[model samples]
Target: MRIAVTRPEEDAGPLKARLEALDHEVVMAPLMTITPRASVHIPDLPWQVIAVTSANGIRALPPGHGLTSIRTLTVGPQSLKAATAAGFRAEAQGGDVNGLSAFIRAELTPAAGPILYLSGAETSGDLEGQLGAAGFACHRAVLYDAVPAAGLGPVDALLRRGEIDAVLLYSPRSARIWRQLTEAAGLSAQAGKLRNFCLSTNVASVLPEHWTRLVAESPDEQAMLALLAQKGRSL
Candidate 1:
């Protein structure tokens, strides 16, 4: 099976490895690109916890933060790995920001400490504001932004050849861009020729009107990958 990974490029390597590990060929057709936002500030703060949603955010962590200084929560395993590599240890993880918010409301808010969020400049989740409204003061550190990737060279050829077996989508931005890329790349005529549409929940909801949406039970790659494997590229 040939899988088209539509995550932004920096994140594409691991998904490609996962597909290859599963014995599928991965076409790295990253529909979106992650561009670090210039002039984004990383606050030097004594905080409650650092919440991270994407590895890109973790990768964008600033210079002065130490691993043991604060508790950390990540939205997914990939971000956790990146956080670890960035020298931030996650004291709690697993839930998306919603669950993390619930956890904070239950546990951290009572501690009455400040929190810092390491996040993309144009992020999907707003854990800080939500937590703030719910009575927690969280400082945020904006790190990166995602824009459409450039030059879909072989993607055109692959679509023309009808070679894509699965379309793997991670974010709504990517999903919308996938539709745009397909149309701009002139692959709309090949609709339904795709064997499956594997996407995380938010991404699935935003897919073009024409694409079949296979929902992952959760937003993590493991969930999407599990859905992709179990659904057997026939969605």
Candidate 2:
């Protein structure tokens, strides 16, 4: 099975390796480039906890920011691992923004001080707005930006030759970008023949209506990989 990986290069490494180990041919078609913001300033506020929505957020932190001392709340296991590896004490993990907001609201109170949210320039969820509505003070700092790829990489040729079998979509933005690139390359018909494995329903919804899509039971990389492996077995 030949699978197209459309995640950013840095985030695609582990998944690509894992897919290859499962005996699947992997194509690297990074849909975005993650650029860390230069000169990120940690505000001098009374921050009781830190919130991280993506692993890229943790990677954007400058060394010795003294944020490691604070308890961090991560959106998923990957972010939690990245946070712990960065020397921060990760207190909890949420499946998504809503889960994270609920966790924070249930565990902490308005007296717990403000939360500093580390995020990218384009955020899919409104973590700050959600927390603020719950009487929690949340400050967001854009630490990185995911710039969309100008064109599809090897995917254009692969689809044209009908070599691609499946595609992995991690986010809605990437899914939309993949669709746009495929259309631009005049390979939309070829792409429609391939199966799309999405990390979540939101990711799948962005794709074209006629394309075959599979949504993972859980909104995480591990679950998506498992679904791919299962589909690989059936093929």
Candidate 3:
């Protein structure tokens, strides 16, 4: 199966390697480029815990500022791995914002001090607002920004030829960008023919209604890859 990956190149490396390992032809067609925000300065506050929604957030942080000592809560396995690799004490909060919020509420109290939420410029959930309303002080620091791709790149040609078998959507923003690019390139019909393996329902919701969409049971990369493998076996 020929799979189209629409995640940023940096984040797509693992997925591409995993797909190839499964004996599938993988196409690198990133719909967004992640750029780290410049002039980032960690506030001199007594932050009790750090919240990371994406791996990019961890990547954007500069090393060696007594950061590794902080307890970190990550959105999923990927972010947990990244935070751990960066020497921070990290724990996975699954892949859902609501689940993370619940975990925070259950594990810590408002008196535990403020949480530093290292996030991208554009986020799916209002983590700060949600945590704040829950009586926890959550300070969000925009560490990176996802810039949309200018064109569809090679995926456009493959999509038009109907050579692609599946499309992997990691985020709702990427799915929305793919929709825009496909419609703009007049390849919506071709795109609709391929199977869409979304990381979550949120990602699936942004894709074309006519497309054969498969949402992962869990909102994580492993689940998405499992969906691909299952689809491959069926094919």
lDDT of 3 by residue, 157-201 (tens): 888778899888888888899889889999888888789888888
Give the clashing pairs for model 2: none
Show model 3 residue runs off by greater than 4 Å.
none
- Give the better candidate number (1 or 3) by lDDT: 3
CA shift at 188, candidate 2, in angstroms?
A: 1.4
Kindly list the per-residue Cα lDDT of model 2 for residues 12-54, writing each as its tens digit.
8887888889888988999999999998888988898999999
Candidate 2 vs. true structure, TM-score: 0.96
lDDT of 1 by residue, 141-189 (tens): 7777777766565777888887777787777777777777777777876
Off by over 4 Å in 2: none
In model 3, the worst 10-residue window by lDDT is: 61-70
Q: After TM-score superposition, what is the CA distance of residue 181 in candidate 3 from its true location, in Å?
A: 0.6
lDDT of 2: 0.88
Candidate number with greatest lDDT: 2
